[model samples]
Target: MDVVATAGHVDHGKSTLVRALTGMEPDRWAEERRRGLTIDLGFAWTTLDGGRTVAMVDVPGHERFVGNMLAGVGSVPAALVVVAADDGWSAQTAEHVAVLDALGVRHALLAVTKADVADPGPVLADAVARLAATSMGRVRGLPVAAPTGRGVPELAAALEELLAGLPAPDRSAPVRIWLDRAFTIRGAGTVVTGTLAAGSVAVGDRLVLGGREVTVRGMHALGEPVERAGATARVALALRGVAVEQVARGDALLTPGAFRATSELDVVLTSGDAGTLPAEPVLHVGSATVATRLRPLDAGAARLRLAAPLPLRVGDRVLLRDPGTRTVLGADVRDVDPPELRRRGSARLRGAELAGRAPGGAAAGAELARRRVVRAADFTAMGWPVPADATAVGPWLLAAGLVDELAARVPQVVTRYRQLRPLEPGPPAEVVRRALELPDVDLVPAVVRPPLALREGRVVAAEAALPPAVQRAVDGVRARLAEAPFAAPDANELAAAGLGPRELAAAVRDGQLLRIADGVHLAPGVEREARARLAALPQPFTLSQARQAWGTSRRVAVPLAEWLDARGVTERLPDTTRRLR
Candidate 1:
């Protein structure tokens, strides 16, 4: 199926042409039929000679309704540009053609209506010449009088040929349905209609709108209920979760999580100079019209800050219009997620950086290079394929040089951490992640290099050694314990020997000392010696017997007996006597 939007002057017979082709009323409103003018978008469809289905979106052509016209044509792939023979070319006709050109609509056909009232040859030639100057280059034209049906067959044949030459739509592309109509049906909750330009939609599909997920309760194509519909087809979706007042024309039904809504973007002007644009303009894309502030970056590139967020991506074509003058310019989106211009001359530098790049996946490498590190999901949301050379560290995609640079800094970071706190082994993963400015702590392990290893959830030096002062204090304590294995030093005695809590903890971590309890420090092998001595006593001895056997005072004996019990070296009986395990 091919959906084509009609464009031309107000009274040039755009609706008339569609009505004649489809044998159906293009105008739905009574006011439109009575006034003999198209006030809003009208829809009709027909089967061409070769059994090809064609849907027509009849758009209003009055200068006042240009917004409506843009909404109708934004998502369609082809157009039927109507020109009246009696009125050769008109103001709305020129504006409509300009809009199509700005939107990069390349496939179109010209219909010279009112052929019976005047000679069609002159108007057809003139209209064809004007269209050739724009993006719709040299469209095929014919004369047709809708009322009398003169040359109608030839026009339909021309349309069929034009539709035949269009590029095939990508059914696998992410779905973005730019709604043209939103209202409530008698039984259905809310219904929205749009031309599905790419991808496919099926009943029961979940679509996103305004950050909320809505289910497709029902669907129709060409007014017939269908379970599924693909690209280039006109579709109406019955939505389950939203009210009619909540949705309106120009809203979009999107594939969930497939897009990132952005308020600021950088674009390359495909048509007009950026310096001549208005400071504030309206941007139209995919049936969405948003007020924007344009900041000229260069002669051909600029930045746009939108009043409302839109789900935008690189390579998306958009039309910027100065509402005051009704002049439009075409732009190709270059960056959806742009860097902030915090410093002076940053905008100019940004423009220079973007000058040489194209849009879409072709520019992915340049994007990754500029960002250095980005979440892989962000790239997917922005509609850019991840670069092949990017290194995946957990959920992050790192530039080729970034991994090496981060790895190179790890050893220095750990060394500095150790220098600041001599007793500590290494920094925790979160501390190292923050020091490296990495997005995820899990990525720290990926960038860890030789001489630095991840151990016990902390980045550790391969040969962890205490400082000279700490090692000297530990040696003094070890010598004291060697002389009297059961006589653990008191807190004041250990403090006088320059061993604080941190120094003691560091010694324990290095296996130089064992902590029997708070304020009780012993040598590493002293616990085994105490347990051996206790075993020599009669089985199930009292605490006093164990204390005498070890020759330690009550201060050391209680903690030692408890530590032994906790270590499964001994168990206490109901009578307060202990025995070895």
Candidate 2:
């Protein structure tokens, strides 16, 4: 089915236009007819001359009902922009256009209704010119007098021609249906209705909501039972394990994990507030909204602070609305920030990057959004219907490529720094910490030792080898130790040689040599022998026994014993008893 939405201000004849085109009243609820304004989404369909069905979505026009309007248009891949010829454009006309653009509605036809009231030529021309400027630029205009019979058939023909050019909706992808209505039939338990969106729902198939998978008890279409339903099809489903109290309007039905959650991301605001640049707008991706605070002080690049968790991806176009003012601001989706919240003003988004991701493909935008972590607030703010229980969120996945690059670069940084500053192995663990930024806590451990590679007070590894002065100092220390048995040249003694405490620490850290303890250094063979003898002992013994066992003095024995005790190799009792664990 080719779905199209009707948009205009309240009482501006949107329903009349739909009714004229479809020969069916779109106002399903009695309240809707009484008020003459659609409070909720109303669905209707009509056959074109060649028997092609055009699913018509009658969207609300009141600013108060913007949420309903979005829900109505969100399901429609195409649209019929209905503008009362006498009223021209209202606040809702621009808002509706923005909403449609944000939802990625690219194909549409403009229906100028109430043509009999005034000369519609000017209004039609304006709508056509504006349509030519938007993503839905190819929008054709038809002057229609919905109350009379003016141009209704011609408009239908034009709509059919417009839809015919559109490729069939892809229902073969992941199942995602944005629910517009939810209720309980005493016998049915829970009944939910929405456009089938994508993919077919079969008998007993799992319906994932809020991370909980429910079974499909039955399905219905056009007031009749059906075996399965697909994209662009209005469907009502009786789902197992779902309750009327638990389900609400604006909730979505999707396959499990079809979207993931995120905390922070990079986005470019395309529609601005009051002549402001469209670099960043408070974004709504899928079933969530985000308060996007621009990074680096609103310098075109921005970071989104989510109100809730949501599933999102790169190129996922989201609806941005000014929360306080309640007007459409603009649309944008995931970019820059992948899994990590970037430093404010650190990076900017490029249109080419987003375009490359979207490429005018069906799933490209959503696929890009999927790879990213978008919070629930973003979707909600964008007028998406998020499931109430859907809260599994956060900690977006970092691309393996970026991770791998960092992993490879860390050691190199350590080596280079060490070589450049020969007198030092590296800055304090904190000093080296500036080299790379990490996304989350889990990544720290996998990169190196627990948390990160740390030494002294700094968190950097030497990227370069020890400098000449430090290298010579290290060689001198080794030379002095080799020349004399148990000769340990202190850092002060090697001060003229240029190696400092940190340089010696780095060499020891790199495992090129061993430090038995403070003021002590030893060869690997000697250390191994000392370890073997200590391992054999079940208790701490006198200095004489240790001397006879390993042939070392209090110089090696005391420090070695302390190291073992620190490692829990042996314990010291109150009575001076030492026993190995």
Candidate 3:
């Protein structure tokens, strides 16, 4: 489905034309019916001659209701400009045209309405020339009259051609629905209606609204319930986990984390009705109306302080209007997340940097990573390529320079850590991650450059050796174990020889000692010697026989047999004896 909005001056026959074509009443309010004027947005739809369904959002044409009109057509990509032949051109018509030009809406059709009241040739020619001078250029127009249904079929054909040329919605992009209505149903908790500008939503998909997540209970597109709906379609979604009182017309339903909602933005301003924007203005973008303060930075650039945070992205075009001053400024969002200006002349430098970015206004790849470490999902949502030159740990993308710098400092960090905590094995992976200011431990191993290694999930210096005190303790343990390779020393004896539990743990971590049992340690190769002796004894042997063969006590023999059995070096029989495999 293609959705287009109706734009024109007051009393331009927009709704009347829609009623004649679709046979449905567009005006829902009794006051509007009584006044015979549109005061709010009205919706209607019709099937074109080519069988294409097009939804029409009929905006109010009165000057007093201009804000309502902007809310209705802010995100609608196409327009149908209605110019009543009897009224010719008017002030509201020019305002609508300026808005379309500011929004960069190029696809449109000019309908010279009320042909039954007067000849439409002069008005049609005048409207075409005026539109051609604006951003819409020359639009195709035809004479239309709702009273006698004159030229209604031709108008539908033109609309179909116009809609067919508009680009298809991006279903793969994140969903951002600018809600226009919210209401409560008897059984359904809350329901909101909006034109799905992009992406697709399904029955069970969760949407973010006002910092809270809501589930989609049901969906209706074109008055038919559906499991999922795509962009360019008007949809009403039944919601769960939210109340009607908590929702409003201008609130947005978005894919969580896909957009950065910030109250401050750095942008490049283009001249509109106002030569330079005032200090305060009314901002209209995607159905949102915000009061903002504009501070000029440099040539064609400024920073905006919005009254509230908006779900904005880089390269979004927004209109700044001051209803009090009657000024308008077209702004292109350059950065959604900008740093605070705390230093002298920082705003100027920031403006220069923003000006240096590409026309799309998004940050460069390296600059994006520098702002903060981003994941693959962030890259996809921002339409940035996953950088190939950077180090990727799991889903994160780290700056190559940052990774290299961290890698270069690992050896120093590990040495300092070991010196401070000599009793421990080494710094844990998390410690290394924090020392480098990384987001998580996933990137720690990747930061270990050549000549550096990670052992037991701890960063280790490749050529690391024990400190002097630990080295002396290890030497005492080695000498004692070598004299009696199988007769392990007791804990008290080892502690007396300068090898305590901490020292033993360090030796084991460094691969210099193998712990056979509690309070029992051996030289690294002593276990092999014991295993060889046990195998030489017999095919099946008792624990006592093994202790005699290895010349050790029950403490060492029991753990040795069990350790050997665990390594598949020997098997234990059902009768509680051991056998070589």
Candidate 4:
């Protein structure tokens, strides 16, 4: 679906033109109709000649309601510019056109309304000439006597042509619905409506609103119920688990974790009257209005400090208008997540680098991926869908070169650690993650491929050799155990044989020692022989019976029996007697 909003001066027949086009009353409020002026956003739509539907968002044209007007047109790709033939172009016309230019709205249809009441040709030519000066230059115009039957069909046909040429919405992208209205229905609980800028939403898909999780109870697209709705469609979503008070205009409903909201931005001034913007302006983008502070960085570059968190992307067109005076200064978002300017001349240095970066496309995306391991959400937030050529590790998008580097470094790091402190297990994932400077610690094991493996939660090379000291200690412990196969050494005895806790653990990891319990250690082959003797004993033997059968002392028998029971090799009876598995 294509959504087109109306823009023009107050009482210029914007709502009248919409009513004539759609045959539906756009002014929802009773006060608006009584006063003959639009006070807030209004909605109406009509089916084109060939079954194509155009959703018309009718915005108030009064200068006082310009903020509300901005909220209406912020996301709509096209605008229906209504100028009354009698009134000609007015001050509000210039302001609205400036706003449209600041927002980069390039497509428009000019309707010289109330043609029957005045000479429409001069006003039509004037409106066209004025539009040519704004960002919405090259607009198609027609004189429409909306109250009468003049030129409505031609205007509708022109709208159809405009809708046909609109770029298809990216339905596969993550959903970001910048809410413009939030209210509770009599029976449907809480609902919010907005233009779905990207991706799709289904009946049960999870979405986040201001960091609070909400579930979709129902959905309506262009006033009709739907189980799913795609991008570029005006949608009303009935949400559960969030109250109407909690959700307001400017808060967004988004695919959870796929978007990040931030208050700071670094932007390149794509076009504006002032090289340096006013200190505090009303920053408008994607249905959001924020009180913001601007700092000029360099030529065509500046920084913004916003009052609220906004989910933004690199290269996004944002309008900077002084809130008190309402003068527009256009900007293109260079970086949505900006670094702090801690020292003098930092903004200029960063601006120089951003100015050199590509605005959008494959080259720019690849450069972004190359700098660090970023989440898939970061890519979405930057206004780029995840590239097909990019490599993903779970939620993280790793540069192929970074993955290769980490893969190559993992074995080398583990091998080095093992050579130095072989008595210990492999390096913890955090250590390797930090060493590699990876963004996510979870990527540690992801790089440890085939010849590498994770052991006891630490990444280790498959054939890592033990340290010489640990190897020597292991050998001495083996010799001592071999001298008396049934006699498991005590801690002191194991220490005397150069096997402290560290060495003992290393020997166990290397398959030379079997730890029955704390202070109880056995050679690898001893457990099998001990279990065989237990098998030869009478059924349901007592601890003393097991001890006599194994010919070992109470110290060794207790842990062995317990270990056997824990391993399911033996079961203890109701009366505490032992039974083999």
Candidate 5:
């Protein structure tokens, strides 16, 4: 299925041509039908030659409804541009043509309507020439009098040819349906209609809407119920778990986690002069219209700050229109997640940087180079193609040379950390991440070099020697414990020797001393000797018996027994008696 939108001035017979082609009434409101003006968007579908189904979105042509017109044509790839033969080239016609061109709509066919009232040749030639200068390039023009059925068949054939030339829609791409209508039905709950520009949606599929998940309860394509619908088809979805008032025309139904909502972006002006752009213009993309502040960075580059966030991606074409003058500037999104301009002349510098790169042609490598580190999921969600050379560190993608750069800094950071805290193991992974300004703590291991290693959860030097003063104090404690193996140093004695909690902890981490309890410290090998002595005791011996066997006091015996139990070397019975395992 293919979707095409009608573009031209009002009363130029856009809805009429669509009605003639599809044999369906496009105008839904009684006031519009009586006035013969399409105030809002109208929809109709027809089967062209070769049985290709085409959906037509009849957009209003009046300047008052230009927003409505932009919403209808924003996502459609093909267009049927209407021009009244008698009216010739009107102001609204030129505006619509400029819009189609700015949007990069290449598949188009001109239909000079009201041919029965005037000779169509002049207007057909004139409109075709106008379209030729735009992105539509050279389009085939046909004179169609819908009321008389003259040239209608030829126009349909031309439309079929135009639709055939369009690039095939990617059904596997992420689903992003910009809804044009949202209303409630008596039994259906909430129903929203939009063109499925890419990807596929099934009846049971779950889609993201305004940060929450909504179930596709039912769906219809071309006014008929369908279990599934693919790209380029006009689809109406009955959504579960949402109310009609919660949704609006600009809301998008998306494949969950497939898109990132951005409130700011960098863009390249594809049309219109950036120098003359208004400070605040209305940005139109898909069915969304947002108030934006445009900052011109260069002649062709600019930055936009949207009043609200939208699920935008790289390569999306957006239209910026001054609501007061209705002047539109076409912009191609270069970066959806752009860096902040903080320093003086940063905006111009950023523009200079962006000018060197092609808009929407940025590869993943370019994005990685710019960001240095990004989540793998965010990279995919932002519509960047994951490159083969991308350095994947867990869920993160690192830029080229980032790992080497971080690795080089790791030892320096560790040394500084050790100097700040003389009696501590190397910094934890979180500390390293914060010191390096890394995005994820998990990436710490990826940047750790040969001399540096992650032990347990902390980043440590491979041979982290204790400070000389703490080492000497630990050695004194070790020598004392060697003489009286079970007689661990008390806190007062360790403090007198300049061994505090931190020094003890450092000694334990270095494997030079063992910490039996909070303040109790012993030689590293003393626990093994104690365990052997306890094993020689009777089965299910009491704590007092174990203490007597190891020649240790009650303060050391209880914690030692608990530590042995924790290590699975011994079992403590319900009566508080212990046995060697």
Candidate 6:
């Protein structure tokens, strides 16, 4: 994909490098140029040879805009990391690399600017070695000096070589563009722009931003209109229906079903300068930010429980920000297990799950690719970060992974629940998941139906349990039906037994006790037959006559007759009551 971001220390000529590379200046805001720093996000346009073009996001190197930096970096396939040759590497450089790791921006060109002044040897070696320790480790450095255009062509060639060596991004999937800027043009409606992560978008394409559906009336990439734009294209879309304020920087513009959101993701937290965070710390991942509780997966790693669903992915580089301390911690998002998980504390270890995995977060649950993956949407329903896709097999999702680890444990619990409540539907899905310590999504493949089907509101029981007294009352009612079917005990009479209101309610909820109406009880299946016979009668009949036809006494007949009259099933204007014609 054409998405790219710049990284390095503050005032390291990152903005200058972007302005020189794109021809269009990224630092349009006066505040930025005045401060001589990229206080906010800056955008520039560049055209690649063979008609391919790219949009550049020059992220702030200052520690203050770390959140803003995360918002702009992702949704791009490649990055242009700008480190000054003179300054070499600094704290912000490490922080920027950490943020890139958090975002999972892997493909890049390490642009060493200010080569005109500083000795290139030490700066080049240091930046490369430092980057090697983070997600941008393998990036090749290209020394350039804007004053004399030194090494410009070489840098471009190196960028080309890096892009060529990299495998083509998956553009045939759904479209997701995280907004870096959203505004209203005078003539056009509200327009939102960002790096297109995948798939294609065209004018009139229906899209969802932050879950609200909108129509795309216009589309532009590099300021030109085309039928469609795919992965790696920078795009601006004019939206219809949604208000400008409704969309924000952190919100994702996605094709429905492209990604699912969740609050819990299994992440491998790297050990570094950010130090150990409090159990609960604020987290900034991709364009989303929220408070999170971290559980140590192991040394150098941890699982994060966020306050809400964030649009993210496994193997996407992640930057953890501790606002209280004003330091940014770096890590690669090796895994994202959905519906959030209550992670048990321990050191995070590298294993087969993350083996051969990219060091960034791409949610891996993508539609077309089936790498270690899980259904992000299923995780979404479970209060987990929404992942882009769910096309991976059962083992890919954490729940699925746990299910494999705990193989027979799940089936065992399910079997016990079934045995205990043979007649009931089953226990709540959460209950089963909690009892077994398995990822909630893992249960999806093993179960016969969706979790929603099992969680139908009321307390579900496996066995239809009736107390002895309640059962006796039920039997008494059944016997009395033989004598006076119409006058069988109402719910109040049943309540006379030790069974309380709550017990009766539970029975009603379970569909065990069918209370037809007030002061009425017929033989099982008798009500329907009685209604059919009564409906067929040609005219109204007296209560005495009705009793003779149904074979019941006045004790049963009088109220039943009144019930029919009240229901308008039959009219009783005269001495005799009758079923309606």
Q: TM-scores of all models?
A: 0.88, 0.60, 0.86, 0.85, 0.91, 0.60
Highest-lDDT candidate: 1
Tell me the whole-model lDDT of each prediction, alpha carbons only: 0.90, 0.65, 0.83, 0.82, 0.89, 0.65
Error of 1 at 199 (Å): 2.5
Off by over 4 Å in 5: 359-364, 468-502, 518-520, 525-527, 542-559, 573-577
How well does candidate 5 match the true structure in TM-score terms? 0.91
Q: 71-162, model 3: which lDDT tens digit per residue?
A: 99888989999999999999899888888888888899999998999999999999999999876898999999888989998988889999
- Model 2 spans with C-alpha error above 4 angstroms: 273-299, 324-327, 335-581
Q: Encode model 1's per-residue lDDT on 346-464: one tens digit a residue.
A: 88888887777886455797788888888888887897888888898778999868889989999888989988977888999999999988878888998898788888887887777
lDDT (tens digit, per residue) of candidate 5 on 288-335: 999999899975899999999999988899998888777887888888
Name the best candidate (by TM-score).
5
- Quote the positional error of residue 244 for candidate 5 in Å: 1.9
- Report the alpha-carbon TM-score of model 6 versus the true structure: 0.60
lDDT of 4 by residue, 420-509 (tens): 776766888888888889877888877888777877777865764567777777777678778766577777877776778777777777
How far residue 513's Cα lies from its native spot in candidate 6, in Å, is 28
Per-residue lDDT, model 4, residue 73, is 87
Which of the predicted structures, 1 or 2, would earn the higher lDDT when compared with the native?
Answer: 1
Q: What TM-score would candidate 2 get against the native?
A: 0.60
Query: TM-score ranking from best to worst?
Result: 5, 1, 3, 4, 6, 2
Poorly placed runs, candidate 6 (over 4 Å): 49-51, 102-104, 270-275, 297-303, 312-317, 325-327, 330-581
